[model samples]
Target chain A: MNLALVTSRDTDQAVRVASPLAVRGMTVSYGQTPAIFSVDMTVRAGAMTAVVGPNGAGKSTLLKAALGVIAPLAGSVTVFGQPMAAMRDRIAYVPQRTSVDWDFPVRVIDVVMMGMYRKLGLLGRVRGQHKALAQDCLDRVGMADFAHRQIGQLSGGQQQRVFLARALAQEADIYVLDEPFAGVDAATEKAIIAVLQGLRDAGKTVLAVHHDLATVPDYFDDVVLLNTQVVAAGPVAEAFTEANLQAAYGGRLTTARVDPESVAG
Target chain B: MGAEFVALSLPPILIGVLVAVACALPGNFLLLRGQALIGDAISHVVLPGIVVAFLLTGLVATGPMLLGAAGAAVIAVVAIEAVRRLGKIEAGAAMGVIFTAMFAGGVLLLEQSDTSSVHLDVEHALYGNLESLIWLDATGWGSLLDPVALAGLPVELPRMALALLVIAVFVGLFWRPLALSTFDEGFARGLGIRTAPLGLALVIMSAIAAVAAFDAVGSIIVIAMFICPPAAARMMTNRLGHQVAWSVVFAVLAAVSGYVLAGYGPLWIGAQASVSAAGMIATVSGIILGLAAVAGPHRTRNG
Candidate 1:
């Protein structure tokens, strides 16, 4: 399947039509409680997009629904113009650290290798090639030295890096990461953002569920402001306004100067 | 005198060894999943099931009794899962309620039935009887090749062969899913692995293992057989594949040694050997578990 070129609603209409990821009218619920409501958004290829919202704003739920980890209560999610299941190998997901057991008895290399499990298939052993790819992913994340260490032994930021390494190993066209910066050290956070920026520069779409409002304008070129539903989404300069922030965070967004260093140069 | 001892002691030892192999295989998976106490619960709750099957059939048929036991165990598992899902109770508490109630019902059933007169006793269920396993019949290639050797050896290979077959089938069929699910449920699910069939298969396998041991060592000692070897092996290894391999080796060793002890140890002590082959095998497994606890890495202080 080919990646669909979606119309950019904010930039000049004549700029060019190219969007790699799109979720149309996606709704998700936990039992009777609706977590997300009819959310429509599109992500451009070769662009880093940040999904920013307050807690309980359905940010994590949206990412999970896109990954097909949780079936949407209503609507559909498409990656590169194909359904989620048909494009399982093309999309990589990095769940939040809190979603997994830190004490699981597996090494960092083992965690990274899981990204290759789907490609390997059942009864398909991990050959030398797979191991080499996994190591390369680790090296890219600057975690090659810690590859053999148990995941539980790593700090929170290190754990997040290991997860990113796993996603890198998948070699997918798109990435959906949930809370990639929560509780990580400053260096680890910068390293993660650098890897993400690298992915964006290499013609890949990166969708991150970000919590720190302070870094939105700097880290992401595009922003989707959400509170149960899509309040706004477009170029960072256009969508990230004080009025939209107030709508999403409900007076929690204090007006402050955006950090210059946080943005991609 | 020595010939008689060999004839009487060898079969029980062989049976104990088989029981150890059976329990050790599934015990590793169960322990890794942190559902170790389910073994205890299944053993206790299956008592009523066996008693009821016996009452209906009027004969201690291994097939029907095992089926009944397995059915009861499945019910217990489903009940545990349901309670955990619906009432939000801990798995251990749910298991406790189910097993105690079922075991009490079994005792009541046994006391009220005429099967009690036939020595279908509960004490025998707890301790087991190695002396009762006499040579029933020797058939197969021995009869075809050499009638004399078959008559001379008097080996009961059928039962042991059957037990080994069960172990092989389960390990072969569910090895991958079992390993994955034991380690991480979310990761397994993310990979699109269907866990329900594997979980059901494990419960059934545990029941089959328990039933296989019930004939040789009785129900209560089956717990030791199922739990001890794997626990001991865990102390020695952390890798899932290595743990299973070592557990099998430990189980076979326990069986043979327990049999030998039951047969020969009594001669030296000059006292009635209170410990049956099954009990000895379990005790050996327990000792192995203790050593593993002491020497193995990842030793939990709480344990």
Candidate 2:
């Protein structure tokens, strides 16, 4: 099943003909200043890949670019060996919690129903079947009880779970999440990580823009260290090393101390 | 005198209902999108456009004047977009600046033009005449496809027919996109809905509604028809579809009531009065808005 087109000097460097998710030479700019520069990455099917980087490291930009939310100044992104536009329905995006106005007057059920909007189109009213599916997704995220409650009424962790339910309702093969764990409690974090693991176990590829480095070893099988460009990417054991962390952090590590609780987690 | 009153006032009242229905259709979309002020701005700013069209054509025709007003409203939208994109101005702020400047320019143009003899005064533009509407065509319904006729009903079918067509078109063409975009523009964009085109179409429709009201009620009063009914309906319901329905019902009621009241109000008060049909309808709509504001359900929590 491993179709390697070319064998390089390093056996690990062979270029495969197909990848579930592939981004090559991606560059993104905000107005005049470039935020991400020529980044290359890939996520194999049925794997959980975590993207870790410092602030302003363009972690969120990379996910947004992959989802076609932000146009890349350079390079291309593909899903299931097809362009993003062609496979849009097959990709689910969980934007950062802060990106949306939580105070918007919509119930959790309504927010979850938004996931079906792509298939439903503008006029396709959410009927019984769609509501059932939304309920199922919410139940899977343990938010079924709060289905009727407005999203703004929920706690921070509960709000994150609601967003998870939204993405879950999409039923997409690939998932892209930006800081799903930020500001969430331990129990909620564990629940979300379990959901991500369940997705990978179900033979789906998941790419998460993560901040907590401590959970990386336990939660993800693959890692991509980004500092504007991909510093390293591969299996977690080999790719996430102290030297690679230093390369990603550089001199910023000298002045800053990594929280023991964060590293120990 | 009673029959004379009905003869002179009925056509304008019917026309006002049509104008309110048209404006309300687009007004729901604008209010939902948090762009409610746009209608008010367009009504004020289109004054110069109407005057210029009259000056160039040397005729006070409704068609050319509406076309000119629509063109100016489109320009204002473009200017707002440009200001937002280039200068990083807030959308509301940009709209405020563009409309105020355009309106001031229109007032200046009105002062400079020899339009007094032609009845192109700013007051006439602000408050239009329903008195002369009898001279306008209110016939030709028998030639239409509908052959079922009420022989002796004193109804102006031509005007009613035109109003129905405008309402049907507004609801048919823009129902879905308007609802989706109004709720969340980003989500609408994600679903491949072209918000800019939808927004432009809505603005154009608003200008048309304003023009229609301008002839029957006047430009200043058109603001009430567009804003008050929708605002009142919004306070009563959170659902966009329901709000739209309520707005139409409210507008039609206000139009009929205002027309009837304006007709008998003078005799009842024992005073000689010539209250504009449009102004009375606008006043009624404003009163409804105030009542809605006072009686609306209060939400202690956000959402």
Candidate 3:
């Protein structure tokens, strides 16, 4: 291999060591009950990491707290070795599809343009280049034709694609998605995984709260098995084991099993 | 028109239109956010605000009244949030409880106070004296060009105009952020949009509109203008920009048509006296909303 290739490979290893997202002793509570308590996780750079757990396992809560979408009761989150506030521009977040009002009066393009709000700043007009960029992002998710349509007119899968297109428009270094595959069609899942893989291939980090355990081995390179606390976290082959899943999901996961080939990797 | 028209009809029509447009502007976002009753709540509480202001100052000054009403609006919002959080009540229930209690307290204060000389009665608070605010110095349409005649305009007219301008500027300056946050608060927050403060700012602007409109148009017209025009406009368009434009048109249409009908509809029926202009304005807006609900192109959600 060339010297440039070898140097880049060494840098990739270094980047993997230094994580894109690191949660240190995070504890969150809703009212009197704690949602996530004293949980810690480190997301590897240039790889897609799946956060899989049972329902009510605080998967969404942990992601929200880590991204500062909701304030944590205690502890801190660092993005790319810096505080979230300082490194906000480097992160792109896609919330749950149901988190927004579907009937809101905005076109698909308008929703996608919102991703560029930080760069546009207050009072900045949407020029032609911005529109072109947004359209290009939509094209990536097979949603370019729906750009002129009202957001509510789309099907659930199309809506998910539009949301992913919006995140793509953000052009951030780290992509964080919350249940991106939930409620979406199989086609949308395939399209989304392809986009995420493209992001990883481009040396960007991705962290997703995944619900389908069956797809974890095929989709994610790293895994964080969580149940209000970190049960196991590392490379998928090492951490996403049947024992770790059993410990994390307890008796809730009855049918999920680790693929032997995936573990052998 | 003649001097009679200039002296009798101009100021109230202008003020009425201004109040309607002001309230309807913020009403669009409020209706979309499912907080339509916030307008209703703010209008009701303004009675207490003005009453306390009049009680304190012993003079029916515009400054004290506006200040008092804004204060009451803030208190009502805070109280509603407190009740929803601490008392574990839903927002609608909390709003209903606080606004009605404050309104009842205001009526009690009005009855107990010895200010029978001023125009601060409960009926005036509800219906407003839109017909009574006439311009005496205007001689004709020539008054439009005469600075001296224009200077003698009703204070409420200029105040309402200024309030409408402020509200319009606010909505304009924050249109993108407001649309993003109102549509998806979590996504907006992730983008570092400071959605909480933006929501509070929106409420404050709504309160300002409520207080300004309440001073001239009464709580009836304030509540009607806040919900009816925007809700009607919503049925007419799927685009927010179009909805806002349609709302302004509907507000103006309601104000002008309602004023004319209230003034002339009685004469057409051979009645000597005019009806309450504020009530007529509200009725006209409700009628517009009813029509839009029935026949507007985008009335249904699927459209």
Candidate 4:
């Protein structure tokens, strides 16, 4: 039985690739307070998965630990069946809009070009082809005209779109975004969702720390309900039930009512 | 200006210009990262580094000074981080406590050591003896180009230039990574660009620039040059490339004009001796920053 189990594990590694992101027993802390505890999850390939949780729910911390931005207290994350460090360029991150000072001296084009840094590496010359790609990404986000404009010139929604455009320029196989929908306009919300869906349809993994439960059923194929830990994780139909939402939201989300039939259909 | 006057003042002006350029490039990044205080902190902290190096080597030269400066820079960063992490103090408070302590330690070391026998002086460390640093044996312009004559030139000038060149190469080679990491550290880390090393590069560069130019410009003037030109450039331009270019231009202008005014302005007012050129250079940089803050393109456009 032991030999059979070992053979099965070997087959799992050799015959099939690991999911884009697999988190096991992950824990993170801020100072003395624990933010996330033993959170286990897997971001399946070629799907849009929303990580839903309340405020201070360790949503951002989970992503930060996974990317090795903040050192995790415990556990590990594997990307594309390898360590994150081994497969880094294949994943891109979009930090929250508020994390950066918009008034920093950089144009829209400059911000987008930053996403190309992974490909350019250190000291690589930014060629005409790179500029063309940045322009194309800007156009995709309806920010082509504002390429020359400074980041401060763009409004909040426009800023979020600009960020999305930069992520597009990265062309990573997996995208991780933090609070992309916060304080965004309706049109920007639609644009962001469309871009995410486009990424999903192109066989890319997109995991976002999303809050708007109203649009969860419409937007995501899978969901990871989190509340300092993984409450439930799987397809939208089986996992994103009212029970999981309640558990993740800790009964604070009084109005959450997901119809299982529609999710299944 | 008279030929004698021009020849006498040229070295100090060149020295000031090089110092400003070196400080401004690193300053731009520091300002962007909101770590402007780090430049201020580094200048003060480098003094003790210089003293400790002097004590260790019993000789003062480019090599020992650079070593001391780099050591002090590392100590300051580590101390600040340690205090912030272990003691749970905020970064600013930690910086304030450590830099002042380091500066005091250097002063104490200088007082305790047999530094009197050396050419290095406390007064020179505070306000550089710009007039005394001239290449005393030079004949004329021809002397400058002559390789043998160039060798006789004061050790400070070449050291400053080499330091500026080092700063240029450091900034030029790592411009993209530095910008990305500074602007969005989390995103940069996600892209697999280790932000820690990039941050370490900035600290080391600041220390090098501070130590290299400190002998000529003094630590206070180093502080001024590190902040003023970049702050002015930032006010003027909304683009990072333009900000860096404009900072260089502003540095050169402040250096040249400040020296000219310091030496010749006394004559304009019918006085005899000129004021300290290093002081004037720093003052001019400040004036330029103030003007930019009020009338810069960013302000008017935003308005």
- Best model per DockQ: 4
* Least well predicted 10-residue stretch by lDDT in candidate 1 chain B: B135-144
Which ranges in model 1 have alpha carbons more than 4 Å from their true place? Answer: A1-32, A37-43, A252-265, B1-6, B136-169, B172-174, B262-270, B300-303
Compare the candidates by TM-score and give the number of the best one. Answer: 3
Docking class of 4: medium
The worst-scoring run of ten residues by lDDT in candidate 4 chain B lies at: B1-10
| Candidate 3 Cα errors over 4 Å, as ranges | A1-17, A255-265, B87-89
Model 3 clash tally, residue pairs: 0
**lDDT of model 3 at position A216:** 90
Clashing pairs in 1: A218-A263
Candidate 4 residues lying further than 4 Å off, grouped into runs, are A4-18, A255-265, B1-6, B54-66, B88-90, B111-122, B300-303
Please give, for residues B20-102, the per-residue lDDT of candidate 2 as tens digits: 77777787767656677887888887888888898889898777887777777778878887887788867778888998999
TM-score of each: 0.83, 0.83, 0.94, 0.93
Which scores higher on DockQ, 1 or 2? 2
Model 1, B1-303: lDDT tens digits are 344444455556666767677777888888777677777888877788888889888888777777777777878888888887677777778888888888899899999998855767777666667657754343333332465644554232355558668876877666766666666555455556666667767867777777656655776557876787777776564355677888899888877877677666777698775556666667777777787788777555212
- Tell me the tens digit of each residue's lDDT in model 4 across B1-303: 444543576777788888889999999998888777777788788888888889898888868887887788889988977887888876678888999999888888988889988877666776776666776556676666778867767788988899889989999989988998888888888888778878878877887888788777787678887889998998888988899999999999998998888878888999999988888888899999999989888754431
Better of 1 and 3 by TM-score: 3
Enumerate residue pairs that collide in model 4: none
Global local distance difference test of model 2: 0.75
Fnat of each prediction, in sequence: 0.07, 0.16, 0.61, 0.80
Tell me what TM-score chain A of model 1 achieves. 0.88
Model 2 chain A: which ten-residue window has the lowest total lDDT? A8-17
Flag the better candidate by DockQ, 3 or 4: 4
